[model samples]
Target: MTPLSPDILDAVAHGAHHDPHSVLGVHESSDGWVIRARRPLAAEVVAVLDDGTAVPLTHLRGGIWEATVESFPGRYTVRATYDGTEHVTDDGYRHSPSIGELDLHLIAEGRHEELWRVLGAHVREIDGSQGVAFTVWAPNARAVRIKGDFNGWDGSGSAMRSMGGSGVWELFVPGIGVGTRYKFEILTRGGQWIEKADPMARAAEVPPATASVVTDTAYEWSDDAWIEERSRTAPVDRPMSIYELHLGSWKQGLSYRDAADQIIDYVGAQGFTHVEFLPLAEHPFGGSWGYQVSGYYAPTSRFGSPDDLRYLIDRLHQAGIGVIMDWVPGHFPKDAFALARFDGEALYEHPDPRRGEHKDWGTLIFDYGRNEVRNFLVANALYWFEEFHVDGLRVDAVASMLYLDYSRNDGEWAPNQFGGRENLEAIRFLQEVNATSYKRYPGIAMIAEESTSFPGVTAPTSAAGLGFGFKWNMGWMNDSLQYIGRDPMYRSHHEGELSFSFVYAFSENFVLPISHDEVVHGKGSLFGRMPGDHWQKLANMRAFLAYMWGHPGKQLLFMGQEFGQMSEWSESRDLDWWMLDQPAHRQLHGFVAELNRVYKDHAPLWSRDHDGAAFSRLGAPAWNPNVLAFARRDHHGNTVAVICNFSGVPLGDFPLDLPESGTWTEVLNSDAEAFGGSGQGNLGAVTTDARGSATLTLPPLGVLWLHHRADA
Candidate 1:
């Protein structure tokens, strides 16, 4: 018999091998997994397994490549040739990794099952407090105590007592209301001290970060009339404008209530239908943008009390605005008061080094295979929608969750079935959350921020989909931003930027986002992302905005983008309001308002069953070399034509294909004097001819919206 490698033995020992016949899912028939690239096909490639085993993955079929190797049970990494083989590509990606296990029995309700179940079955509550009552499944703890501020940094009071063979512990306390913090001090059979957050606490102190808090959540929603107006899901046909925001930094340093008041007022005035907040869950570090979650049950206390959060949602609902909170279930921070040393081991995480660590984010990933873990996540997702009345959840970092080999360097990460990156357990958990959320609250939407080319994530669950309602269109965002930032002379080569996304536009309901991710870590601001002189920069921005609003997807803009804030955003201070004094910056702001105004008034902007002609029948480049023209049609066959020029040179006699012979009125223009533009064109309107085309004068780097009127 072949000598078993230590990794192979450990994998089986720790319950990592369930099939009994496979390791890393590399059976004889399928020795390698394949990856297909998008454009700019890579030339060279290298691959390595978790045990430092290297294998060369080769490009073979239709931008797809594959490789295979002998027995290896952990994750792997790959580097590909890009930019003429001179630039090594770092797309922040990783392949697959597997895990191994050990056979040590500490405690069990019966026979300590998977890590998730073991940690999810114990219940503890505060003493004499109208607060949280939560359960975990640690059947082996000799003593489990509730720690943190409510008990004055002690666990002796409000302690959990074992309840016989049920393998459960129970406690009930009063007076520990919202903001009363706590954690679990668990003593295992091995006599080790493990500190953990109360798994079901409603709100925890997030910044000046400390212990989890108990919150008796009760909100007197005075928006019953408003609730009725938005109780049902909005039609997919209506304009879907989302105001993306970060709860901590969006409005100077405001509480959840403060942010909500500001956003609700803004949304109502600006004609947007939704407000999407960045992650609000309890996290050890603020810099992770809430991606490094710890307390799944609690809202971040840095904002306000749990009830205050609920009040924020209520106020938003009152203004007929939808609310969506960012939810991170992919990984947890390794803080002592969090999930790190729970039960004196990596109880919530995988025992195998490959599965336990997330290399890119440097966080601890969850053991999703454990039923109890899946249950915990699913329950948490459902709880957010049900308890908080949140209209939706924007799941963060889903690509990382779905893949086992994300961001692992050579010989680092793990693999799964088919020697691939798919984490079946994570996929199963997402499906569970989708089903539960839709079943419980049909109106609540679920959005995924999955950058990987994962198909069907927003499709119907009955059709084997992940069941999210929408997903962030990362491809569109990346490609369009790059194209728009280029000089007009170089744009023709990249003019397909807007059209290229059409390949996957219909695959899911996509949100075209200029999110916080693009504005940080030296990426500069949105306006900064553009090239050219000041006037040219503003013009390019206006053109980009016009095209984005006219694109065939939902819309989302980060908070400060509306007013052309010049500085990069930071949670430490307010956005740069002083920049609005500049002419070019002010012009960009006014252009956004006009875009929003036009988007709100026109049915053609978002009407479903989009007229195919909108993306077809383009005139040649010479008519207006820098301009892109398209038309959107409503159900009644009414058409609205949009044209954008990204150039710095003015062009007259720009010929545009006309749908009718009547005169055309210029309903909107980014260069209008009121918006700080030079006012170089006719102020109110213009006319068009009937011979399938018309001529008009277009100002430098301007956009125009023309409507058909029968009379000249």
Candidate 2:
């Protein structure tokens, strides 16, 4: 037998070797071929070749065994006897590198758009043998070993080989398949060991248990028609009434599959075109609502497996409702087992605390300047669209990513090269991600939850803009909700608070969101926000919703608000669904359903939403009367007039100017008895005079949708 170096054998035995495959597998020496194996706590070790030759290996020291063979065994299995119990398994070190040169090149260059496919623990087949190939990037680590359930949580014999200059470590372990729980045991340069979950894991253990899962999905989708249609249609041109909800609290104790039918049926019945879920990425704290993501690629195992989420999305798409996931690329939590201080140094997060930390959120900001980090986030966006078949991504906390001094004091931030607060690297990353997402998926919407006046948020990246398909209209939400929360007796002086949204409504593609943000943190529910007794509260809510739908933008309402939920939102429990048992609540729910039906049936409400010519103010705001009116027109010249009365008393013979002199049908009346209203309205229909004027009876704290009859 050829003599082996004692230091080399010790390195392999201790799992500190950077290239374990070179010394552990079969190698040719000057005299003959030699085979080495490392099986800790084994009484005997043997190499059995495909030619039915079993050669006993001599134990040297520290579980290292060696033997000389006359010929090189092309394919072989290792037999190890522990306490006289012989176990046979394919040799992991015999196989070639699972990742290719091109992949390594792209990964090193930070241009690997499909980084998830290459970097995580993946169930793969090599040489007709089923196993998993694991890869991770940790340039500063002295060594990395694969430790999992298969190895008794030990990595002594599973040291991974480093790919030079790429900072990537890889290992292909045989005899392991899907559903295996694993984590990387990395040896830092300081001689300390740290365990981390894979950043690109497609599936992970349910939070409170941080381990990357070796997973392979075989989910068969039935949404080909939905996908094909989405590719051709633009979200901006379509009607998008998003129902935003937190899946965990939408109904407590329900898995993804269990909630699929319920969510699909409820959203479809409510006439919402899409359902926007709170961040579904794996997070340790359920209370974080998934904003602080640890596993960027893995669908939170809290909802079942990754495939379970795919099934839920598939069922929704098959039912004709699109899914939008809230994505958080702004920051990650500082969990020890996560990406914080990865590789015994600052890796995924920025090294500088001023730019790297979010003091308000107590999270670590991503190092957007790094190529690999940028690639990691950009690819995560694509993974959701490509893997989950999601229709859109509502990027969370975009304002935090755009400005370096966001939520920070002047002395706590470092400016860009041009001495500006703008984070140039993050801006570049956003533009790249948006442009790439659109180029790859034509109809997918990339919406930003940006609360600032960052110019051109929805403009094209080619035109030097951020290139988001839509931005949440935070200004509108704050102003409108503030206006509606006041007593009706004092609302006349606050006309601008409600009407101000129209001034910049068309500035960017906006979604007038009464989102979860408005109904949380002691801010009460939408029903609670209304300023009046029970009866008038419902009236104000109906009027507010009517005005929102009639406004020149898309709409997004948080869960529970549709039925006038009385309490603030809580992620710890299910929504107040029991409120539906009440008559007034049921009526309000019915009114919202009918309102969505009317909104969808009328093209004038959505078709030309962004065109200035399609919208016109109906006279000026009637401050004393506490009334607002607007006219919306479609390409076919069909007009729908929306009139809202915020006063406590009814107005008889209210003079309103029509876009045309003809019969106008009262399509929707919030004051109708069917919706718990006072049953006061303009008797179904009215005729306008030659001057395009009509005398109408407006309900107290109510709204009306008047559609012009084509035949008249």
Candidate 3:
């Protein structure tokens, strides 16, 4: 065997290989338990621990493959192949970094006073017929007791029994089950009542925010057919048009079931494959948009009951649509009765102000260093998959969790030992969560809505990556919005804007979304963003839509975009359907329908392997004109070319090149009369080309999609 590189050995020494067989230390994060390690020995990183088990890396960076391995907790040795020499770290080289041994020992010590113990509330199970077995890890706590509704909101009567040697404390309640709300009261060095939620709490029912809890019971799911159908397919890489929506405002006067029925019917007709719901877990306030979560296990009752939510997912699956739930694990609200004051003191929060408080959102950050907190989140991610049959999860606000100084200045925020903004505990927890979830279920997808320039947020766990299936392409969204919302003249000078997205397209899967968040707070709707006469505006909108659909990444259109709704979305109000009666708005609707048809019918558009045609301005950004064009190639060598004119005036006869000589048909034209255009172009017509090229008319603020038949 080739010897592992020195860098790999050093990385493994620092993190990859740990004693206690804990290859990756367990920690919690806003998203989940994440595992982090230096890039492993590619190809040397095997599925099994045996010598022959190996997988090769296409390329190795710095002799490491920084990856997030979900299954890293298992017994495994780090090995590497360097110049055909293999090296593995045996027990002799194993060194574990403990909280007390690090340079940041003071901070770690302060957190351990109570936060560390409460964070290890893992391994929850049925202790007896009527009792629930709860345990935690605060080895230093002078005393720990159970407190909640089950114990009359008091911790003394049903205090837990200390389990020595494991830094664990256990408590068995005679009448507790899944629904019984509970917290922990512990006496630590600070001598304060630190009331915190059970780290392993599966459900919570705190009122005035999110009310009542229930026991964890098995649902008689008929989703077996859906799971089987899903396993048989390789997840539709193409045809992945997603409708990003906020469930509470999806439809007016519609219940969760009503919204599901309407949405499923509409999307099926519109040819979308998935519905990505904005965080569904019960949060305290509606204005928080479900980000300030209070109940990790229960679906928000505001939308409907838990069972109703399940039914909605099941129905979506039945309609051949996948469901992606937005998950927030970054921060918790400071509601006194909930997780904040559980046991009264800072149990789940950091004792240090820098780690405990998030100044940006005015919330308390999680102490991810705890094992139980890690398990609570890990199980939560899995809970959605197993109970609701959710096909995917979209981790929200990841940037805030990954860095300690996410919104703080040098003096305002605290730094790690390396003087980096990265939260070591948060990073470790995220890696663990990603690794554990992916290991248990391979096909289920984990998505990241991270805003930072963090590399590899969607990389595989085995590669020392974030282990997410996809990351939101915020760059694409920002650039596209900037380019499309500009005047034709200004856009012409800024034509190279679209080229910026390709830099990171291949690094990880990306989703180009026009989410609900954009249209709120006086930003107006998509149609309202246009800066022209009604006709010019609709044409501009149509051009933008066609461009968005033709872009490289997966597509997500917020609700009301398809129907050309005029007003900004409000949870208390319904989408403005009355606008559809107007002829001008009807044109936008028809054009959207046509765009969806073209997107769904084209096989080239569906393939997402980064092997499609794309072009941009060659040089200096300012001098280049505004324009982006690309072709989607099919397996049969056929291609569909899409060209857009972001300008306001006609370009007369524009020149074009084709892959093959043929009679090109204008399958769909955004400039046609049927789509609120000024009767400027012929519809359903063909232009002949022999030199595999043609000169065609380019309408201002329009999109032209041309198809070439094999015989042509």
- Per-residue CA lDDT of model 1 for 21-82, tens digit only, reads 23222333344343222112567665555566656665543333445555442444455677
lDDT: the better of candidates 2 and 3 = 2
**Best by TM-score, which number?**
2
- lDDT for position 518 in model 2: 89
Q: Please give the TM-score that candidate 1 achieves against the real structure.
A: 0.77
Model 1 — which ten-residue stretch has the worst lDDT?
91-100
lDDT of 3 by residue, 1-712 (tens): 2334665444333322212122222333444432322333345432223334442323334333323333333333455555677755321112232212231232233322223223323223331123454555555565676666764776544444444444456544444555566666666556655665544444445335333443444556666777886655434355677888787766655667777788888777767878888888877787777888877766776766677788888888888888988898888888764666454456567767788888878898887776545555666787788778898888888998888888877777788889888888888777777877666665677788888789878766678778787788888888888887787877766765766776666666777888887788998888788878777778888888888877666788888877667788886776777787899887787777777778778766656534434322212121226445566666666567777778887765556665657677777778888888865553464464666556667677887777776655
Q: What value of lDDT does candidate 1 attain over all alpha carbons?
A: 0.66
TM-score of each: 0.77, 0.98, 0.75
Model 2 error, position 602 (Å): 0.3
Most accurate candidate by lDDT:
2
- Candidate 1 RMSD computed on C-alpha atoms after optimal superposition onto the true structure: 20.8
Q: Which ten residues in a row have the lowest lDDT in candidate 2?
A: 616-625
